[model samples]
Target: MSPGPRLPRRTLLKASAALALPWLLGRCGLPENEEGLRLDPDGILDLPEGFRYRILERRGDRMSDGFRVPGQPDGMGCFAGPPGSNTLVLMRNHELEPGQDSLSPYTQDQGRPAQAYRPADNSPGGVSRVVVDATSFERVSSNLVLVGSSRNCAGGASPWGWLTCEESVTEGHGYVFLCDPLADSLQDAVRIPALGKMNHEAAVVDPTSFIAYLTEDRSDGCFYRFVPESPGERLGLESRGRLQALRIEAEPRRDMNAGVEPGATFRADWVDLPRPGAEDDSLRAQGAARGAALFRRGEGLFFHEGSVYFCATTGGPESGGQIWRYTPEGLQGGMLQLLAQSRDRGVLDMPDNLCVAPWGDVVMAEDGADPRWPDEHLRILTPSGQVKNLARNAMGGGELAGVCLSPDGRALFVNMQGDGMTLVITGPFQQYTGTGL
Candidate 1:
């Protein structure tokens, strides 16, 4: 079947009246007949008239460490390079499996690292580091940082390091691993079992509480939070913690896939899991037995302004998508709100990864619900519940993933997973980002 129609390029200006969301239009200060996406001459990506993208890294490209760039670039995080430096560090993940040896970064002669997790097997998924000059927007160096993990899909950045989560449970590889961006060579493979062993999609740490929030990528997944024994530890992932699942205060075992209003709010509580580090794939079931709330494939988590924003790839009545917000009130309780959900696939289809804009808007990476029509896009969801396209994948090679903005918000980095391409788009970002919200 054919997919949904594409949203009009001129829709952003009229959103205030059409959706009655004046808060977004008033704060954005966008002018009429501007900020519309124009087709790229190369037919790879379409962006606004003033915006342009630069191909930073791609599959098969050789790195400084003498290994070719791996395929299936998924989730990524951008960090400041170093003190008194004008460069930025990017940790990119490759979602490869054991049999995909052709896409491995290591050659046959080199083999895998001695400290790799399950070194006997041939798991090629890991994280790679790329350094770029912030001023010039040029790549400085690229190399492998972590190795031997399976399906390092989507992860989040923390002050300690990048929390790269494995999206697989086979061979005991469904745990989160922290990778230091400053490490030039491959680091030892260490898993944080305290974070729970399940099909992890992404993770983020609350700066104030030092508690980590994680998402599971299964249809029956449950949202989780980890409270470390030592909250002040620099590298808190290794510390032992109590893992708990979210539960609705009013209703127990609430299914969040459908029948949720756009602005619905709920008092949220947590239930502790006796065994977070389980050998089998039973963490979700364990949470369910204890009255934990359920989600439809939870993915892509970001902590912004004291709230955690996450997405459910296949939620809503039409299975389009859903974006949720969780604000931790204290160590014991929080408020959960259904910020926005897609009723039409054309407007917001399968939002996989997302990041908040510098000016307080939510930016999303669209993984289209249907593969037949490959018009995936990088979309923006306003606080007032309006959606608009920021960029379109004209190439139709893959779904957009790893949507992140630099610390300075001058550059936006995204990846095309199936095509194995990473790009940085730069333009007049300040036009929409007014003086803070």
Candidate 2:
């Protein structure tokens, strides 16, 4: 069966309708269309100077192992090995199934459905590598990395190295796996069960402390963080760790208990009530729950300037899809800031995942929207709560998922989820931001 229809590459920007949502639209002012740049009905996805995109190794791009890379591609990450050794390790979530839809040996089984993420089974949906040149934006490597991971969505890198690909399926076996693209074969894939058993979207690690802040893609899913009892020496497997929830301002809720590392926990470890719906079994219940026991479908996460920031596809009780911030000085003290409320930001248009830029701006990808909207876009928000239209989706009709600006703050890499391709953006980063604020 075909996947969800591709959202139009360009759609009209949803001018904020409410007086209360400037924090969502962000600091940048919306620029009226001019200069004749291409945009779709969704009003999203714009490419910058000295840059253009093409279909790289597409879905059927034959791998060394011989199975065609099928299924809808989702979350991805890129690493620059040495200079210009652009090897991109992408966790392409297949959203696959059994029967003819299954890959290889699973097809021979006849009736039994395959596990979503057992790589040893060599399933079709999971993580893969795409080596490219940073300078030229050309794909160099031609191998698919990990295979059986179910619904491998957006994942981030640990400061040391390696990528954590998240399995976004609640049932039928879901997990989070580590991938090292530079290596010849995949090894040491960490399956941290304490992180919860919901449909996970992505995770961010604090290299300074080695805590994993993760989000679930389900509507009522809960947000989580795994605190390494023995901190991993930066971007690696720690000697020990425990998964905890994000305790909000209303943390001391009457319902749940406290975390094991509450006093010692450096990151937020108390989970609040998600929504009334979050009580579903998807949550990997462990430490006593607190605050909002549910979540609004957490997506992506990043740690910057001593603060851990993440996104929820669906917002909270009052909001729908919000970008939240949490700062903790260990279990001693912390605060969860609502930050920018999206219902007021460009009609929300349905945000998926997000990344941070050099100017300390949070860039978000708007993927899901109603049929009425004609364009989709990658948005940016400053810490001060300002939003701007960074790029318009012009990959014909692709959902821009993962986004990142190079370390030197040069080129920006964006993944087109609908088409399974990565594009690079360069030029003025600040001049592009604006705010209704």
Candidate 3:
């Protein structure tokens, strides 16, 4: 009959500060790999000492709805079920294109809907929902939620529901769609063109401010934010708002691809764009003309404590990756800091989707492609700036995506993009010590 305890803002802020201290000290303790990675007998994944994983959903498994599981799972969010229930509702995105007919529900004979967002095209990209019993790690049901989109790459979870974004800029595509994980049918999916049309990757919203920050996954990308006219109202609908791009103060059109020193803070402002839904894919170009700072492939985005953290997958001089933190100053300004950059492939390679762990660590999924290290990894970046491998891909070199934690922090869920598998890892998560900040 009572609600769960909530983390106070002050406590979260303190925890964030503690996590940043290690970076400020300029001395991150090396990752603890004493036991090394335990080879997985299943030949799927390699984990550290006390961790193990289960294959919750595979590419072609039959779902509770009689439809086969879609392939190329990307961004995902976990929502706690009704009060006191151990169930969790997960909305997962599929980075499928038009030709992946065999793996999509739309292309399947029996599960095809009467209509889709794009009724004529029959694009195989959309979102799927899965209900799981957290305590047992058993899947309750899986069904199609959104349909007829292209490359549903990465999306963000909102206090209200799920915001799935398309990573395509085709004339009729490249929009954000809001899906209710609780919805029983596809009729509820609504396209939110107000979020702007571009190569969208993922998004995160500030609960307190009601402001949504998005990432664009292009070689030349611009960091963006959507300020809804009314906070907490249905975004893109009743909460119509202005879409803007971030610009570094006194550094017009600065190319962040060269990388910046860690802890280097830059005053930043948002530049308003007149037409966010332009079909020409010139949104970033228009923002660039107005001095918007450009990033090299912006990917994962998350709002934590009082700051927004995101990754530029191929941003550094080495073309490895970069993570940046943006702390809002007030209504019109903010302070941007280069949190970390990958100078070597061994340390961090092409960081992709990331999430703030329940225990205050930043869990990053590496999408790196280096022949030297044939496999990819699930890396943990402690507040103290130390990076450690938590899990490695034994299933070839498929890039990991959709790294999120269960509501209770007991289960960590992730996806192997290339293999079309969703994995749930459970372990002595709280006992592991991160590099002290």
Candidate 4:
């Protein structure tokens, strides 16, 4: 059968009438409680009034492929299945590392396949595909799609498939792997080494330029972009690319983590990294020496409209977090803007994975470390500079990750990483009037 029609990428700047009006008010005040988050009686997740959640999949559950659901779920993406059908496909990441409990679909007793990235290593850090019925919110099936990797922390979605990245630099690891979510069986894993080998966090692609932007989870990480040798070509077995790091045109080696105010705009350029996948793991250091700007703990990234939005999980003067916007200016380079910074833990504490809501606002998942962080929330940043609570975690401070909305915007899907649970939230989401930035 032919593949389903692909879902159109959501625009980053498109806002609904409801959100556009309130945004015009400009942070004057928050909306009433009737439209605010409501407490959850289950003591797990608290959402706004009229909103409810259902656990779609839990770790340890036996999947259709006979393998148990892996733990430590991280980044994910939603895709449309068979054309004009309610079928939806979700590619989820399992953030497992070496020496951890074995959750891999393959067991040593079962004998590893020669195609595995590291057959000798048992820790199963990879991606899984979950098929669901969007109309009824029923799970059709779940199965392991990619395996035999390490610490598959977070990744992004492309026009063609899911891009899963490793968070380790272990010789054969620390590379990005692409997985087709609609496939019936696991395909041979292929690593895109040209994307650089570091503590990979997340990535997003600009469909127009076929340029992929990636983030590294290191404290001194440098933002990077991969320019494929053949622009707009499907990145596969025959593809080769050039990796480059970001640099501020005026302040080449500026420390973006310090002394930068909101709304500060910087002209940016790319510095070519002659050796991205070097075994020495000196990608960041080499790029820095070549005038690339540095970021503190680069984390989640998403592409919307013509710009790329990303977060620095442990940035800001207070060591809270920061969100930045980069808009490409064609061949003239691009512009980077600091959209928001966490000045206090109450506002946004260690923001992690993020996504653009259907209404155009940015929704962030908090990875706060405080003991009281369980009360941390999924924060929404309005275009008018107002930050408001969208949902709160009542489940013992499990860092929220992989926040994405269904293609039709009827349901919002997110993961509670610590508990290895995926949730589907539905309700009066459209009533939200916060103007998106």
Query: Across residues 1-437, which tens digit of lDDT does each residue of candidate 2 receive?
Result: 11123333322222222122223332333333322234333433455443344444556566544445554666666565654544443333343433325332222323323323454444455565655565565656555455555656777767655445545443444566666656544333555554445567787777777777777676555667766666764333333455556554444322211221111122244643233123244354432344434556677777776677677665633333666667766753465555554433334556777776656667888775545544567776654454455666655545777676666556666767666555566666765553212
Model 1 residue 111 distance off true place after TM-score fit, in angstroms: 1.9
lDDT of 2 at 30: 36
**Model 3 alpha-carbon miss at residue 220, Å:** 1.2
lDDT (tens digit, per residue) of candidate 4 on 34-145: 1356657777787866778999899878788776788899898988876776789889999997666655555345555555667677657888888889897778899888
Best by lDDT: 1
Q: Any runs in candidate 2 off by more than 4 Å, and if so which? A: 1-28, 31-51, 63-70, 82-122, 163-172, 186-189, 233-239, 249-289, 316-320, 331-333, 344-347, 383-386, 395-398, 434-437
TM-scores of the candidates are 0.91, 0.74, 0.91, 0.89
- Model 3, position 399: C-alpha lDDT score: 92
RMSD of each: 4.3, 8.0, 7.0, 7.4
lDDT of 4: 0.77
lDDT of 4 at 177: 89
Shift in Å, residue 118, candidate 3: 0.6
User: Candidate 1 at 311: error in angstroms?
Assistant: 0.2
lDDT (Cα, tens digit) per residue for candidate 3, span 1-437:
12111212110011122334345434444433323567787778888778889888998888776667899999998888766777898889999878788878743466457647775676888998888897987788888788888899999987778889999988689988888878655654588878888999988788999899999999999999999888888775445788999999889899987647566678999999988768889889988999999999999988788888899999886787888889898989888888777766656779999988755678889898787656788877776555566788887878999998987778889999899899899886656644332
Candidate 1 segments whose C-alpha is farther than 4 A from its true place:
1-35, 234-238, 432-437
